[model samples]
Target: MGMEYQLFYWPSIQGRGEFVRLALEEAGVAYLDVARTKGGMENMLAALKADAHPSLAPPFLKAGDETIGQTANILLFLGARHGLAPRRAQGRLWAHQLQLTIADLVSEVHDTHHPVGIALYYEDQKKEAKRRAEEFIASRVPKFFGYFERMLTRPEHRGVYLLGARLSYVDLSMFQMIEGLRYAFPNAMARLEPGYPGLHKLHAHVAARANIARYLASPRRIPFNEEGIFRHYPELDEPAA
Candidate 1:
């Protein structure tokens, strides 16, 4: 690539930024993980304050003169440029819509562990979290998976991906979703996986991709921990119905 791709995100967790990282890694694009660089966190904070276009949070991407924020927005831009998205306008919109839906699920997942507020500790909200988790595990999980299940059953989407016959950013996002859900709710996923065979198949297929498999084995991929959106709190999760 002519322009240097600079990714500004927190250095520790695989948060939202990991979605952007996955596209870049899959496409074999060379980019600098700016925050991981020397004084990278300082640089990211400084850029946020200094740049003419302000971003509300991290996981922003800078490419030459243009800067983009939001994981879906970043993925949309990268998908079009890197052949990670469909060619038609309708296909593109469908993919973007799917990504936005995934974003919604991510937010819900985060809230399961922090029902009160991000400023408060999880311990402060465990009771609420448990209630929220019950609804989420019993309702939201099947609802979201059902939507994708229907999409995959479409005539055009005969393959493992959510879009067309090929893998798009949406598929990658689904892979990330599965990874997070499994890490956070192993028993729930194990029980639910049987019902959503297509989703599990998609997840396994994406995991087997050459680039993704390599990325998984690499040091670059951060392991899931307590800090990320998907956290494994024994009380916050339950076995699937």
Candidate 2:
């Protein structure tokens, strides 16, 4: 493609932007990870404030003169544009829905640490995080993963992915989620994995892809840390049920 796409996200952590980056990388598309570069986050913020329509958050994309925000929206836009989305209308809608669900899970992951408010530090809300993390580990994680597992096992789509016979943007997203959750809650994931063989296989499959393997090996894939979503607070994570 002649037009280079620009992705705006936090400079340091992978956060939500990694979803978009993975899709772009898998496609081998040439694009600018704006915030990762020098002066990139500043430029992104300036553009956001300068625009008539201020974005609700970071991880927006600037294609030509237009800018769009929301993690799932960015993926949908890129998925369609780059042919990473499913071709059939029904499949496309299902794929987008899957992506939205993944986004919801991601937000919940962030909320485990920032339940009271994003402004508050994890230490400030460590008690609250403990409570939220229990609910997340005991209820929410299984619910979300169960839904995905069932979807993957559907007769119409009986394969490793949400959509059978192809790896869509949602698959990349699921892989990211699996990676983050493993980092943040290693104990929980270890116990949980055996039950979700479909998800486990999907995670392994995505990691094995040539582009993803290359990306994971490269320094560009930021390490998970306490600063971002999916933090590893020992008190918040429980041994698998």
Candidate 3:
């Protein structure tokens, strides 16, 4: 805890980095958003290459001398250190399992905007993106949201958070998911959100947390933009049937 955690990621756009940021903020952990600092981009680039176990991409964490990569892996590590995850093996694994599922959903969301390839501009893949987004909005949205809704409404875990009564990183990620999807697909969400009352309630619960509220109000919380996973492309979003 003495060593200040250093987060290495892109200077702009919340992207996947925001998930980690939200966990840290909610846990009241002090971390240096390295890329936002002077010469920080260079530092991030260097860390990506120089580390013993180089990460495939950004959004990795450096705690003390250990470098943790991947969003879920990093979260798994931080979740244990902080009280952001469950104490027991079964509960912790359950939290991580939900996190992995969320990761899959996030990947799908990214592909909707960049269906053809990440290297290609959205303009180059507009037709494909439209098709993908249409299917996602029609099918995937309900599939994922319904699963989470049911999870929250389970018999045993009858709480506002995902892992039941406690506030886990899963809840934080769900809040981000709703926030991102709402930005990316406002029309669709406006029509669809009413069905998922538990998610709405959970979103409100996380948003009102003292630390998270402060973070949201501060400049540290980057605004959603075209560059992030959640983009407000008018054609890609529509109200549900």
Candidate 4:
């Protein structure tokens, strides 16, 4: 069958849409990136301003008649429908909880570059960004990684994946998180990653998956740049400790 779902997001930057893209890609689901299509971006923007069930931002999913918004909510729906989530309620809830944590991490990462305000240019907030990025590298990164490391060690947890043996949406998200952090804070990650063996292993494992490997090699994988959430500013990166 042809691709049925329409993913509405900024065509240039990976942004929050990448989480949804990874889930769809790993599931091998055929879907069109609406904004990437001709005249589709206009439609997406119009939908954002529409009167009915308007999406507040990009990364919204149009699945048949349902319009779903929010990165976590979109993943939750896709996970259950596409077998990327646990079949059991408790397991599913755990996956959602993990995803929420990932979202929290993402927001903090964004704030590091735009500490003063997203409306302000990075050049305009260079001083504040430097301070925020330092704090993120020294404290936030470890605290988040510490939680993820502990989560992997839980008795019920599967060493290979966040929830269990099966790859879930949370796993894909975790992969994205690691990728973003490494891109945005290479030195910090290089210094900090050795302490997070499990997270490092999982990140490697996800990248090695057949589908993901193919996806990364394809045009669908947008190059990480300053326009995206995970920006690389040499001054923001810490020296290896």
Candidate with top lDDT is 3
lDDT of 4 by residue, 170-215 (tens): 9999999999989998988888899999899899999999999999
* Per-model TM against the reference: 0.96, 0.95, 0.97, 0.97
Compared with the true structure, all predictions reach lDDT values of: 0.90, 0.87, 0.93, 0.91
Worst 10 residues of 3 by lDDT: 1-10
Q: Write the per-residue lDDT of candidate 2 for residues 59-124, one digit (tens) a residue.
A: 888888878888898888888888788877887898999999999999999999999988877889
By how many angstroms RMSD does model 4 differ from the true structure? 1.3
Write one digit per residue (lDDT tens) for candidate 1, span 121-222: 999999999999988999999999999988888766578888757999999999999999999998888888789888888999999999999999998998
RMSD of each: 1.7, 1.8, 1.5, 1.3
Model 3: per-residue Cα lDDT over 24-75, one tens digit each: 9998988999999999999999988899878999999998889999999999
Better of 1 and 3 by TM-score: 3
Better of 1 and 3 by lDDT: 3
Pairs with steric clashes in candidate 3: none
Residue pairs in clash, model 4: none
What TM-score, to 2 decimals, does candidate 1 have? 0.96
Clash number for each model:
0, 0, 0, 0
Please give the distance, in angstroms, between residue 161's alpha carbon in candidate 2 and its true position after superposition: 1.3
